[model samples]
Target: MTLQQAPETVRVTAAVEERMVTPSLSVQGVVSGAPTREVRFEGSAGGAKQIVTSVAVAQDASIAFGDLLATVSGVPVFLLPEGVPLYRDLRHGDSGPDVSAFQSLLTRLGYLRGSATGTVDARTLTATGLWYKAYGQKLPESEGKPYVAVDHFAAATGEGTVRLGPTVGQRLEPGKPLFVLSAGQQAVTARFTVPEADAVKVGTAVTVRASGGASFAGTIASIGPFQSNEASKEQRAGHDVRVELSLQDAAAPKEASTVSVTVGGQGRRGPAVPLSAIRQGSQGTYVTRELEGENSSGTPPTRDVTVAVLAQEGGWASIETNPELPPGAKVIVG
Candidate 1:
């Protein structure tokens, strides 16, 4: 008599899911700079011996046109209400592009009248007096005549927050950086090793999170050339690639601050399962499912199903199958 053996119960377990995911890469970076600049205050009056006697504005002060920045040799150096930098001194008789530009600014500001002739005459002096009076300063009459110091304004273009470069009781030499202006816009820079050079590209969207600060979004603006240097005694060689990011959000961390940069891996979603559920064999990568009904041999029947990997993250593999997988379909893990 042939004895029939009961079918052996085979048990396998696996975790499954149907969730959306986006691919990404994360790296470390630093805040490079702000959109504003640290412009140096040049000596005005085109003289070799200009000295600063007093500083008017405090650190983190908002600077504007006609605002007194410093008092040089008892002369108030006001912020000019113009965009272009003053490259030369303008007196009562100077004529050039600078004079024309100054004349035009004064004319537009209602401080001067008539066309800009690029020549400083009585009209220019009258305009200068009006400008000084408007700012509550005495009409500057150095050497017994109305004059505009070449470095008269000691101002920078663009209104923004200011950082004092020189302290009070300090002298501002000619062509020295007197203050730094924060323009409110900022950028971040991240460096990647040689192995990661190809992965970093310009225009790639990135999420930047500053240390102990709010998170912001940016795009890779530029990638610098490769550089190699000697490492340590044991590790001889190392390479690096520099990446600059232009941030869209204004509330950025301070410059030279460290931040985290995440880039790449976007636009993919599907059913996710344990990585073990994915099997690689002679046929290719696939998953298996045990048939509900048993074979004549009284054993569970199984079929191999092909699948394409969409993404892998956090021990889960997102996949696409030829035949759609049901929401709760059982997949073999081992």
Candidate 2:
């Protein structure tokens, strides 16, 4: 609208500013494994339920070659990123959640018992033994102190004990669990090593190219404070950065579900505009300016200013102001 119709208190003007443009990179990543089948057994009578575990299907969700399988109650199990894929020989157990965290899930889900510290500890083993006993099978004592037999987890804690009957201590409510178990679910973010020429800071925005038929959007979650080139050439000069994409609301079909990930940091800087003159709107922004004399044009004269925001506090945008534009400039906003 023209400025003539603008209210007397309205300010307006055309704004010029800067915005950073980011480069896009292509990456190869995967969709963490999913449960194929679930086998659950009920105890014939006391004796503890024989909850032999295996996946309805078998998935070697192991990221490392020697990495062990994640299982519980005959359910082909889950995992988490054991380590940096590059350094750890490109393992994918870290489908999205942490496997160590899953050990805990098994305990809480009543599927397997014990502490879920990501490792197969005595608590986990004891829980397993109790589960086996419920199925009429006798489980030998664990090799360690409370007798832990789950060898995968060497760092066990507390003397693991079997809670044969329904957890005896107290009645617990569902949804209001005493502890949380990791489901092995994780949001995939693109990671890249920056060179001296491309080193970027944390919180930087990145424009991710949707490849492998999957479209995901996100920002720079972390830029390693320290630099390491032990993995990729890009790390030689710059640090390794992780970019996260919140796929919570993204529309992705199953076909591209497990697509590879590639990422690039927002190469350009954020928007830079003078906060003083901008009038925010529900959908967009407009500049309101006072009419020259009371008999000006009813339409607001707008510059269609490019808004590149840097920092804004209070009511002002820490931006470069237009010299020709006067202060208290009011424009017609309709």
Q: What is the C-alpha lDDT of each candidate?
A: 0.66, 0.36
216 in model 1: Cα distance from truth in Å? Answer: 6.7
Best lDDT among the predictions, by candidate number: 1
Q: Which ranges of candidate 2 are over 4 A from the true structure? A: 1-45, 48-201, 204-211, 228-236, 248-334
Candidate 2 weakest ten by summed lDDT: 154-163
**Model 2 lDDT tens row, 1-334:** 6657656664444333344434444444333221122111121232433332432122222121111222333221222222311111112222222445544544554757444454445555566456545444434342333332222221111111111112223332322311122222223433443221133445655444444455666555555544445766743433345555544322432323444444353345433334455544433343444444433556544443323233443333333344433444443333
Once all C-alphas are superposed, what RMSD does model 1 give against the true structure? 10.8
The C-alpha TM-scores of every prediction are: 0.52, 0.25
Model 2 error, position 227 (Å): 2.2
* lDDT against true structure, model 2: 0.36
The local distance difference test score of model 1 is 0.66
Q: RMSD per prediction, one decimal?
A: 10.8, 19.2
TM-score of 2: 0.25
